[model samples]
Target: MRNLASLLLLFLVLLAAGPLQAAPRRDFANQYQPRRTVEVDTRREGDSLRVYLRFPNRIAQRRRVPLRVMGWIDFDARRPLWQDTVRGAARRLRPDGDVDRLSFALPISRLVSGHALSVAFGDAEDAMGGDAAWLRLTPENLNRSFIFIDSLSRPLMRRYVRAREVFGVDAYAPGQTLNAYRYPLSSLAAAPPMATSNTLGQQPRTLGLQDSARFNADQLLRLPAGLYLLRLGNRGPSQGLLVEENRFPQLTSADELIAPLIYVSTSEERQKLFDAPDPKKAVDYFWLGVASDDQDKARQLIRQFYGRVVVANTIFSAHKAGWLTDRGMLYQILGAPETVYRSGNEERWVYRGYQSLNTIFVFRAKPSIFAPDNYELVRRPEHEFLWYAAVELWRKGLIAQPGR
Candidate 1:
């Protein structure tokens, strides 16, 4: 049995370290992962690249929370071509509550062949194992040609992509050509949207909404150079550049990312991790056992699988961390859905597995006192087999086929 003495010592250490460096709070109310509180959007322009960061009330209300970030652009074989750290306050970003915006522009030369911009939170790395995220930099396009439009409603996309009441991609959608010009990206306006005609080249759903057509505000943001996740504010995240997340899958701490395992971990595995002096080691060993003793296989599986976990936390956070949300849990465990059907009040995720068999998970939009986009999973006993099989694949280092 684990003794109280060791537990007490660990608690005291965590307590003394204070909020920035404290252990993850169990409340799910007060403490949350950085991804849950902060939003990062990177923009590129020739040798000059701009990064825009958004901080919601969760972070804005807490003045002492680290509101600083450091970035390194890797262009040279030996060292970074440039690096910078940015600091700001929530009040300067906005007058009140529309999500504070912070922007940083850097001079990045097009001469570099392979490039990537790495960014990290300035403090609290030890507490969360990481408060960092990065994206690849592309310079071939000097001007902002691609526009990222998010939270576009379905009624509007019907006019552009002709999705016809289904969540699917229309490669030929002229929404961008027809709509992008109406909604321009603004760090200030906060609500009015502007996008160009070519913006909706493919994706059709909420993002394809006719909001731009309705509001009729034509402020244009020269397309930010690289892929970005666009937020039109107070809605589900939509693809930018039809973008995929770029998460640096480095193994930092198992304790930092233990939520995904709770759905699958055995009682004994849970107990062992709780008692182990180094919880990360215990989690790693459990994965090793799942990998049938192959260390490399364990690392790869952990990286890809947990990469989904990190992505969920980054995108779906509501009242609590995204992973705790019904949609986020399924996302972390099952990977991306084969197709995500979105509307104003609900989101339906469809997953097709081995043999083309399909399972569906529905989340009804339920706004809470804390967050508006919160959702509740429509669960059933039939999910047991699906859940068991999904966990089995993960246990054997396999992944489920979800979607783009």
Candidate 2:
């Protein structure tokens, strides 16, 4: 039995170290997977952290399965530095149509400083089922000074504000003057540099300031569509926010609908779609072709594809729209990974592969002055075949639908 256990451990280590294929497995990193039970958002407020948990309304409305909320602070990813149970927090559910949200204020002032804070919610029976979030925390993160959209009631986890929504500034030290600046969204959409490759010290493209404003705690802000930065003063740390038209991450316009098709459409095909007089109709026609004139199949394909577009925008968005980012492209085409592992500055997404092999994609954190959650994919020559193959599977309606 001892020899058998040792061999099994060795096999597991080998699987993790290379591109070996295997069945879907569970890990401690469900935070990176598409959530099914709840969505978590956290922010720093002085010496305290504010956490918001949002779950499907049915979970509360049914009341069949008891729910639990738990959290902890950790220095290394392996062990908890501090842990807490939100006693009876699940009983206080504020319903909002399809979802319900609960808020908690965790005072971390007395606890030892930690690098990451995690909160998880789900079934009381299993103690874990809903969703979890692992947020990077520090002594002086930008969450100290951020804008709150007064007109929006949902969690501000995505840092997205609709154009023309009313917003108010919040700072650790109240009544301080805040400087807000806006910049045009960058126009580049290429695969990120590989792990083995170097950026050649290349800098992100320069963006010109489009607008600026001054405000205080008592002031209200409303801006046109662009990228906005909120800071304490001209030289303070800035919190990046995205101002989008329509409900963001949702495809409502022709441009939003057409942009995500780049992965599957040929150059000529994409140009025609863009040049078409009726873009919505063109998009529908394209999907219909992929579905082979089957209306139901076409509908399912469209729903799954664009559904991922919305989720990509929600979870992976940083400087640009999520569906346009490297991870976004992969998520849109391939759906969620079977397993996700994270470290200080990198993430590894593993998926079941063809034949007897498994596939792994690594993303390195490339935080910039403008986008803190920014990550670049470790691009490779071999990945081109995987990408094209997945695109073909999508076009052929052969890919499984769900968890998009």
Error of 1 at 57 (Å): 26
Model 1 TM-score, all chains together: 0.40
Q: After superposing candidate 2, which stretches have Cα over 4 Å from the reference?
A: 1-38, 42-44, 58-76, 87-93, 108-114, 121-130, 139-143, 152-155, 172-174, 190-205, 235-237, 354-356, 400-404
Model 2, 1-404: lDDT tens per residue? 99999999999999889987764332434454445535655556766676666655445455534344333343234445555566666576777778767777777663333366555554432342213544556433424545353645445555667788777665546677888789987545555323234543464567789889887754777878888777887776567777888878688988788878877777788888889999889999999999999999999899999998898888776677888788887778778876676666777777765423477888898776657767788777666656666777887876542232
Local distance difference test values of all predictions, in order: 0.46, 0.67
In model 1, where do residues sit more than 4 Å from their true spots? 1-254
Candidate 1 residue lDDT tens string, 1-404: 36888899889988898755534321111112333445444434445655655555534555444444333243112234544445544444542345455556665543243344444344533122222343334332122322233233111111111111122222112333222212221111100012223532443222222233211112333332222233322242222321111221222455545545776677677777878888877888888888889999989888877777666555664333455566667777777665554433555676756324587777776653234346677666666677777777887777654543
Pairs in clash, predicted candidate 2: 20-358, 21-357, 21-358
C-alpha root-mean-square deviation, each candidate: 21.9, 6.3
Candidate 1 clashes: the total is: 26
